[model samples]
Target chain A: MSVDLRSAFFYSRKDIFKNIKIFIIITLSIILATANIIVINGLIDGMIEDLVDNTVESSVGHLNIYPDNNERFIEGIGIKEQRLATLKEVEAYSPRISATGVLSNKELSVSSTILALDPDKERKTTKLLEKLVRGAAVNPNDKNAILVSSRLAEDLKLDVGDEATLAFENGIIKVYNVKGIIRTGNLDFDSSTVIMPMDEAYRQLAIDNMASIILVKLSDKSMSEIYKPMIMQNLDVNNIRTWEEETEFVSNFANSWRSISSIISGVGLIAAAISVGIVIYINIIHKKRQIGIMKAIGTSNAFIFTVFLMEAAIFGVIGVFIGDSVGYLAIKYFEANPFLDAISQTWISARFEPQLFYIATIFSFGVTILAGVYPAIKASRVEIIKAIWGT
Target chain B: MEIIKTSNLKKSYMLGNVEVKALNGVDTSIEQGEFVAIMGPSGCGKSTFLNLTGMLDTPTSGEIYLEGKDVTNMNSNMRAEYRLKYMGFVFQFFNLFNELTVMENVMFPMMLNKRSNYKERAKELLNLVGLGDRLNHLPSELSGGQQQRVTIARSLANDPKILLADEPTGNLDTASSIEIIELFRKLNQEQGQTIVMVTHSPEIGGMTDRIIHFRDGTIEH
Candidate 1:
């Protein structure tokens, strides 16, 4: 009995090893599909993280506070002036005055969105200073010092120390030194945004203690949801949009990427399942007679199935490992490339994160094992008599 | 005393709307330590009879007793166990797994039975068959006669009470056939093994202690 079991194991092992070409092909297919899943998942994860980071740092807080007539800001001129006792309640708040205008230098002119901010207060609440790519932050004392996005600066052919005239509504023109160029990932922001001190912006727009919105940052992200209702009840606010609600465009874009990644991963998993099924089915067909001979010689169906399942599992493991490694390397390579920086400035923004690697590895391995089940079952159900007689 | 007995054994194959009766109401008996040759023309169900006796196939309607245990109604797994424990078969095609060495082939059945010291027993069998020096050779590397000797060693691996051969030398040349016959004769005479061999050759059949002629699925004499 021992001899029979030893021979069976030896034969099964030899059979598996002898079919190295099939093994390699199956492994490669699984690896390719797994790699695609991992890389796509990684990219989606990175994109979402980048979107959230940019949203939180550049514009939206975990929460937002505004006047009761804030809903009117979407269509027409909003609250011209308001006294917000925000310092006593929130962690930090930056008063913002924003409008669409045209920026011009000697050689070029472009339409841009202008933001007026209190530099000291904004610095305490936002990431504007850290995102500067070419110049210094806007001086709170210099009424004419303005910061422009990298794309806008490039379009107007303006650099640090250059003079640029900002033309606002009612023929108001403010000339300012190009204090800094910043790059945020949002294409809309990167191409057409300019920042100036709040007082200077109020003067340009002919406003008094007026602002477009008041941005708030809290100590805890979850606190936004809790504090939003209290702020609404205490203050005569028209609407309260959280950072999550404010960054709808970025959120939507990230959501779409997530959907696409899921679809791709789903398709990859299906293809893997089919590939494994077909390969194992073919293997069963090829070895039908051998299977019969083994059964006839007293080998059990369970044992035969186990051998095939082991082969499928081996394929899955090998493929998942190789694919995950390749996908990780690809993501890393893209993250570190200078071209990515250029692309981020021009199109979408990105950051290199290690967390994506772990997520990808887990997803790749999981999908591979899921894909192996059908093939393993089919292989196990091979009928001994029919297999022996080629039926 | 009879070691194997089958009563009213019947088998049929359905070949796409046509029922081909492979065996019909066959009754036979063989004693222990007896060398018997079953002889028949083509389509006489000689091979089918061997399959039933070896527990490789089930009868359509019959009762079979091996060592006085009724086994016709045994399930597949049980039949396999019985075959593994009490029977050994040599096929016409030499049905050796091509990848295994001669020693490994001989050791296969013994391993299945969980027999200890398989190498020692395998070597003894190989030496008994005069192929001890060729243990490491693969089936393809040996001549027809040598390959049949390996099959013989394999069949004897489980220490079965009865050995069944279905044209064991059918594919071999004249010298190989005679050599296999001589081996079978010696195994029966020296080791006192009960062997039932099916052969078409009258000359070889004549050498057995008893020759049962089969015709139309029934043993005549």
Candidate 2:
């Protein structure tokens, strides 16, 4: 290192400790700014992750296999099920048949979608059983039992254990007992949907070994794109979609939240930069005479500028370190005690992302150094005669 | 040998909108190992002469030579490097850095010069100034005279060829002033140190080997 930089390092390090009180106040502001950015971003990421998880669990099970465009139902579904079981990538699969019907209670009637599923298979492929808001899940043997979504039950004034009659478009009518109430936070699914047993549905609709769609759960949801093509080739089906594609409704909201999070973080960092600049500027003003004396004694302008920048860098590192620790602890606390979201009927916790913390640390440090530049230049450019003589 | 020479050295700056000539058409030279005093009244360019010679400020269209090299138009960085390598400054205010210890203040020039064993050299200089025991004390902890002593010690840290003192004893008591002048005399006679001091006191001026008088921005014969 050059003498200017070396001397600057020495002076800056010692001076920071010498002026501990003022630097402490500056550091506190930096800590708050960094922590706010981290915590706010973490919460947004957590909410988005929850949305994606709920979409995968309650509705899209990583990947979905649908019938051809011209066909109402998939042919040879039993053979397809056997083929899907042979693939190691498939964790589990459930075939479902959806039929539009009129669901009526004693006092009210509403248009609803009757979704038929194998209860035992559905439990592995989706979260329908786990999301039960009230009462027990539908039993596979009890063909007369059914699960009704909270919104549909509310529209028909129906509750668990109540009898509701469903009239399909094919002139098939059946009365069933509502076994449970589930809320997936999916507006379309929760609003007007009723779940029933596949065996009973096939008998009532006069069909066998056929399904309108097959939901496939995978070991890792991120592999959906890779596995989708493989599944399509094996089943000879042209209609297949990944979970990310199936959750367009939630993805739009997630994108908006990400943009909002960036704006909030940007504002917070700018405030921190301004605070750092003002403090360093005031410090330079107070030490104007000292700077003049240094120049008089042959200290270079480069030395003066480097000293102030080094001091600012030290402050940034200390503050960001403490802020990162605080943010991490906060996320852990939130994880231990998650919020109960009424709409999703799920617990939401903050996500702790190491990549986000690293980026925040680097960006905050860079901003702090930039903030010190003007003040350091001003210190370096002090007129020796006027500064020393106070003219 | 001429250690320093000024050929029609001039400097000017605007006081409000009017240009004030601080120095004008002055020619002089100080031989090597000479102890000279520049005596002048207030507003007579004594400090300006000292500042120009010390490379702390630039002259306006005139030439200055230190040991035969014309050094009139060096930029700020080059001037700073030349000053560090060859000159030392003692200000009237005894401007020791208040935050640093006496030892550290003395070592500052050496640190800038990138010299090794600066701690030992600073200790030796402080001891010569009779502040060996006050090494760890801050500038604020010392008396006005002691702080001036520290400044003198700091000025000699780099072993510069010329020591320039601007009213070095102006803020000191009579007893302390005599001590500082006696220290300068001892340094000049014993070590052959070259010094150029600016002062208003004839008593201090009489102690030096030669005295140059100034009036209205020019030296009086």
Candidate 3:
């Protein structure tokens, strides 16, 4: 039958508003589901951003190289002999000497991961310079100057220019001047680290002409596969790791968060579907007689279905707009509020992203429309005689 | 020429293993431009007969011919098309879409037919029904008589050949019932519109050109 599009629109709109409570409930359910989806997705994105920022800023460059024997943790009187490559092959590279040590002052002592790096090369290889909370980057030529984390400095009561004694294995001990303090907002790294020049580390540990590992930065991430094997072959090092491989813990954590968020969003979607279905079903029941009257007046079933679907589409649009606004405002509030500091300290920082908001809104609207199908069909299937006679 | 003709029409209901016959081998014909009323007591199958003729219900057995075309076994879609092109209906309750204004209610059928100038046509119909001044009023805002008048205007939206009214005045007061009957009479006399109304009120039934009394699923006269 030729259905009147305008009449269907008018009739559906009237029915929707006439039963205001159902309309409101359907819209509210859609909004809540959409908000949950947006917030969960936002949280996961924030966590990934934080993990990548922390990993890239601290020590792991885009790539890393270690001696073939470095994996066995061999204890020797001196550093292991290994062939090193020319610096010209890499965009940038930094030598690092990593070992466990104890930091001590007049009043306090703490165990920390002591990383000795060539500061000038480190600056070019990573975002280390941007993460400093106080003082300057370590001087490549200063033998006694060292940089410690803010938490370590706080624990040891050491300030810039203060002398701190570091004790290593085999009765090795060195006293160093605190040059700077750094806070990366990552508790795992910020609470237990110390940085010094590689030469200073070699002298203190009684090693000569040796470095534990080399960190390299490529011009682009896509070039990692090409450079990784070349770097290993040139340096004669079989033990190597990329940033993604070395940071399995953080990557796994982010993956788990993603999966959990998807599950939550899935549940929210199902709830939205059920809510819309129930609302449309009840609406059809309430309007059966009206539908019958329309049909008896020569309206087609297709027209009836279109009318209900249009009502659902309208609800979806309104709900998506409302949910997106609320979700964005909530994210913005979290970004501006100091109460989120606890999360930032442990996880990642939050930021506003308009793209995510739009994506969530469109997704919510699509879901609402899909959920409207069965109810519309049921409404259109109403028999005219039974409906009009209340049978 | 006959606008509606039915032969050996039968309809039955299964009420928990009890077969109740609503229409039993009923043969009837309605001529074009003729005003007729079907009168019967409660449960005498007056409504069932009207529904069958209106194409709203299917007869269990037999054939229905509209303008010499067999439509007994046609699909629901075809039935709807036939109804839209050839028939109009008014219910006992004045079944106006309560949310719509008087003009909108009148324009509904015209919209279904994809008729152009729907606004102008709706306004003209409302004026003809003496509701031009109340065109913007909702169905709930109007009196029962006024609501029925709107229903009458709605029935004429497509200018259908026949108007099948099922108890059109069943719920109205005496004065309102008389008004509706007079309107139907005018449509038949002036517009040459055929009308078949099912009513229990003998007073209203007396106004039609012919009366077919029904008893136990069969027409008596």
Candidate 4:
């Protein structure tokens, strides 16, 4: 009378424990696979977060606002104060004039995208001044002041307090003294972008009181989605863009990475499962005679099968514990001192998220149990006479 | 008072598509509390007869009666249940699970049958077989004769009606063989346990109350 369900487990515990080598091998395989998934997932996730953060801090703020007609890049969005009346969550907002033009110095000339912005309001919206590597931030009062990337400064052969000429595609030209050299490290932006005062830009491009776009800032980046509707009802629905929607390439890269890593983890799990299956199959074959004798002595076939499954589950639990412990430590280490990618100048941190832990545990157990089924069936179907004779 | 009676019992095997008869239409009977030994040369089907009588295998054709009830047609699982309840078996190899201690091996059948107080029963059986002090010893730790004693104890774990032994001393030396035969003789005489054993040695057969001779899968006239 086995009243206690765990009696069988304790009964056979020594049988599996005696085979320490097999347990060690299975545990190591699971630990290695689980740790790999955790670390790799964290690294990829971290890289995408860094890219989004850099973009938000340097250019897109949180949301972009435009005029009622979406197709026409509707210059100024909130030139009339009533258009932005409902924006309570907005931390900062700036009106900007944007154009693509050529910048020329005494020796070199290169085509670049130009932004005309208020130094005070734009400072609060985009933090354009904090990215400065040299000189000072552009001033709205100094109509002749311009900001350039260090990379762009080198490309145009211009320096701070140096004279430079800015030309629009519509054949308009203006001269200004270089105010700052900023380095955001975003390759496309760093290589070809320049900035000036909104009034000076509009006057030089033959524009009037209207600006090209309004960049809005929210306290939290995630709040942009929630507040987008409230802000959209006051303006044009079709012309509103959250920073996440505007940064399509980052999301695309993140999505593609997720797909590729999932495939890699899938293959790793299969390999681990196959390894476990092979080991357990060999164990069943080795224990064939014992299984036969158990059946011969009145132990049911189902009992033998259940013991095998229990053995696999034991291995699964131990493996998950060790793997998750190691993985959690690795994540913490990487979170504190991230893996640096010198090429992108970004720190890739490993996040110790609860979801990753849950997934790793479930995956390890699922594959281990699935591996046990065939061997368990084989043990239950053994012929008692043959096994006794062999013994 | 027939404990087991077999009528026209036959069993056949396939040896690469050729039929080989292991038991051929044999009719056999043994009374309750009888100590019986079936004697034959190797491959004479004496072991096969004991296996069929123990319900370890089903007959190819014919019937087996246990207490006047037909059991030859019982399914394997039901037959296993019957084996657990009313039959015990001792193999020539003394097939104790290598990992289990002597007492644990004795407790296996009782555990399966849900017999309460099995731990105490297993201890008593081990003490009866004179290995009481060796309860915690693994089978590999004991000698061949001691291990055989363990098997005998395990066979009687559920206090079954009949003990079926196939070449029980075939692997023992002369001294151990005589010792095991005397043990079986004592168990039958004192406990009145019905035992059907198959053996090649006539010297061992002489100790039993009855000897049934078998030749080429049939009882000798």
The prediction achieving the highest DockQ against the true structure is 3
**lDDT (Cα, 0-100) at A307 in candidate 1:** 60
Q: What is the C-alpha lDDT profile of model 2 across B3-108, one tens digit per residue?
A: 9999898999998999999999889899989999999899899999999998888899688999999888888888888888888888889888877899999888
- Minimal lDDT window, size 10, model 2 chain A: A1-10
Q: What is the lDDT of residue A165 in candidate 3?
A: 91
lDDT of 3 by residue, B1-221 (tens): 99889899899999999999998888999899999999988898899988988899999998888888898888888888778878889999888988788998888788778889989999988888889999999999999999999999998998889899999998999999999999999999999999999999999999999998999998886
Show where candidate 3 strays beyond 4 Å. A2-7, A17-25, A28-32, A70-91, A104-110, A129-138, A141-145, A150-164, A175-181, A233-236, A321-362
Clashes (N, CA, C under 3 Å) per candidate:
13, 0, 0, 2
TM-score of each: 0.83, 0.93, 0.88, 0.90
Q: Which stretches of candidate 2 lie over 4 Å from their true place?
A: A1-3, A154-157, A170-174, A332-337
Model 1, A3-39: lDDT tens digits are: 2344545665655565678778777777777777666
| Best prediction by lDDT | 2
Q: After superposition, how far is residue B133 of candidate 1 from its true place, in Å?
A: 4.3
Per-candidate TM-score, first chain only? 0.76, 0.93, 0.80, 0.88
| Model 2 docking tier (incorrect/acceptable/medium/high) | medium
Residue B191, model 2: Cα distance from true site in angstroms? 2.9
Backbone clash tally (model 4): 2
Interface RMSD of candidate number 1: 2.8
The total of clashing pairs for model 2 equals 0
The residue pairs that clash in candidate 4, if any, are A1-B114, A75-A211
Q: Looking at candidate 3, what is the lDDT of residue A197?
A: 83
The positional error of residue A385 in candidate 1, measured at the CA in angstroms, is 6.5
